[model samples]
Target: AQSVTQLDSHVSVSEGTPVLLRCNYSSSYSPSLFWYVQHPNKGLQLLLKYTSAATLVKGINGFEAEFKKSETSFHLTKPSAHMSDAAEYFCVVSRNTDKLIFGTGTRLQVFP
Candidate 1:
């Protein structure tokens, strides 16, 4: 069974510190992993994806993740948090179609 597990359901960060959203996954194949951000009243936008390639992958808006096969994890990280970063984030495991098995989103609340 291929699925993603987000360690936290919610994260609060001040508008300047770093952001870390932990995610762990289980898969039968060397699956594809994705992090998507959903702002208020908006659909999900891809932040990053690991397709069994690089160990460390970078994506939009100063975000990145390192695929650790041994750990069965791909955790999202950022150097700085922003007010606009307040949103719901989903860790995804996908094979075909954009149809991803999404983790119960981690709601990020940014404090000013």
Candidate 2:
């Protein structure tokens, strides 16, 4: 079984500042991790993914995450925040199957 936790339910950042969204996971086997974003009333879009290849993985929109096996963490980050970056982010995990375990979600708010 695989599960994920997003530490924060909401994250606020000023425009142009760095952004961070923390996530932790647990799986019986080595799992595939992913970060996804969803705008209001829109379908989810993949931000980045990790599949036991590289520890550091880059995603769209300047976002990246490092897969830490020992710590069981995969935190999402972006160099600079933009107003358009504000959205609901989800941390997902799965082992072999298409079914994904999704976190509650973290809502990012960007302020000028």
Query: Model 2, 1-112: lDDT tens per residue?
Result: 6799999999999999999999999998899999999999999999999999989999998999999999999999999999999999999998766798899999999999
Task: Give TM per candidate.
Answer: 0.95, 0.97
RMSD from true fold, candidate 2: 0.7
lDDT of 1: 0.94
TM-score, prediction 2? 0.97
Model 2, C-alpha of 29: deviation from truth (Å):
0.7
Error of 1 at 105 (Å): 0.7
| Model 1, span 7-106: residue lDDT tens | 9999999999999999999998888999999999999899999997888999999999999999999999999999999999999998856578999989
lDDT against the true structure, each candidate: 0.94, 0.96
List per-candidate RMSD values in Å.
Answer: 1.1, 0.7
Candidate 1 stretches with Cα past 4 Å from truth are 96-98
